[model samples]
Target: MKKILMSACFLGQKVRYDGQDSLLEHPLIQQWKEEGHIVPFCPEVAGGLPTPRHPAEITTRHPVMVVNLIGEDVTPQFLQGAELAVEKAKEVGACCALLKSRSPSCGNRETYNGNFDGTLVPGSGVTAAELQRHGIPVFNERELDQLVEFMTMQEADVA
Candidate 1:
């Protein structure tokens, strides 16, 4: 069975910056759980950030850096986590990841800006960017079914 990389928060884990999860309870995730094809991960946590971490956003720079509202640079940790997530995905031969939306580490599109203001910009997160660079398709909770369908197509191709 083809395994999928997943954001731990979506798996009902309290790994978010606020120590809470944005649970989607999507059926495809449940199905994947039943099949044991889910590889739950949190790039932010994996990068050494605390569970109740200071919320960070992508900085306005050439190579975006993750910074908290207090303007502390956490880019190395985010990059580390992203790289580790990629390694894990490769280790399990996962071709796709169901990531969190609007997260600094796992967002697939439109993450928060680094200004600490309530705003959004079009872009992928650190982990999402890494996964995409490695050719792993990344999806948010809203795209769970599409991910399932895409995975199904991949399986069919292998068959």
Candidate 2:
């Protein structure tokens, strides 16, 4: 079975920056969990960030700078986490990724605009962008159905 690189919070793990879980309750996720196809990961925590840490956002798009609420540049941690995520994806042979939306590390298509005013902008998170650059298809939790379809196509091709 092809493994899926999934956000730890999506599987009810309290690895979010605020020490909470997003908990995706989709049937496909449940099925994959039962099938042992989920490889859970949290880029922030894996990159030496503690739980309940300060919320950060991508402040610079060109260089992918991440900064926290107090204006401390956390770009190195985010970048290290992204690199480790890509390594993990390759090590586990992940077919794709399902990440948390608006997360600095896992957001797939849109993330916070770095102003902390509840605004979203079109962009991939650090880890998500790295995964895509390494040829992994990334989907956010809202795109579970689409991910299922993509997995089905992948399976078909393999067969």
Candidate 3:
């Protein structure tokens, strides 16, 4: 069975910056849980950020700066977490990653624009980018079905 690297918050774990879980109660996730193919992780927490952490975002793309709402730079921690996440994915032989959207560490397609003004832009988060760079495909929660399709193709190739 191919394992999946998942964002902890999607597993109903309170690992989000606000100490909340972005629970995704989907049947496919339930199936993966039953199959023991879920490797739950939170890059922000893994990088040494605390629960109820100051919400952060990518303030710059060139140097990839992650700054909290209070203007503190947390880029190093985010980078550390991203590295850890990639390692974990490799360790578990994860076929893909299902991450939280709009998160500084987990977003696969888009993250907060770092202005703290409720804007969004096209981009991948730190962890997501790392995972991708290592050849692990990343998916947001909204793309579960798409992930399933990709997984099917992977299995097909193996078979």
Candidate 4:
């Protein structure tokens, strides 16, 4: 059986920066859970950052560039968390990740801007980038349908 990495918040965990949960209760996630494919995780929590911590954003020219906009430097902690996430994925035999978009730690393709102006931009979160680097396909919450399709195709191929 194949496994998938999931954002803890999306799974109803209160690990968001504001100490709240995203709680995206969707049929697709429920289906995946029934199929035993979820491996929930929160990279920020794994990195030792407490809930309700300062929300940081990428401040570099691109997502690939490592720079923090809220403070001096948090790149190392992010990287460490990313590594740990990847390790956990490996341990669980997960080949894909469903991340919380707009987060500095889990956003796959879009994240919040540090300007605090409620603006969004193209970017990959730290853990998302690391998972991509390791060949783990990462998707945002809205992309659950595509993920389900992809997983179905993979299952078909295997069978």
- In order, the Cα lDDT scores of the candidates are 0.88, 0.92, 0.92, 0.83
Ranking by lDDT: 2, 3, 1, 4
lDDT string for model 2 (1-159, tens) is 699999999899999888999999978789999999999999999888889999999998898899999999999999989999999999999999999988988998899999988899999999999999999999998887899899999899999
Candidate 3 lDDT, tens digit per residue, 47-107? 9999989899899988899999899999999999999999999898999999998888888
Q: What would the per-residue lDDT of candidate 4 be over residues 74-139, giving only the tens digit for each residue?
A: 766677889999999999999799999888889998877766567998878889988998999998
Worst lDDT window (10 residues) for model 3? 139-148
What tens digits encode model 1's per-residue C-alpha lDDT throughout 9-79? 98889999899987768676788799999999999889999989888999864686788867789999999
* Model 2 ranges with Cα > 4 A deviation: none
The TM-scores of all predictions, comma-separated, are 0.95, 0.97, 0.97, 0.90
Give Cα distance to truth, residue 115, candidate 1, Å: 1.5
Ranking by TM-score: 2, 3, 1, 4
Candidate 2: worst-modelled 10 consecutive residues by lDDT: 139-148
User: Which residues of candidate 3, in runs, are more than 4 Å off?
Assistant: none
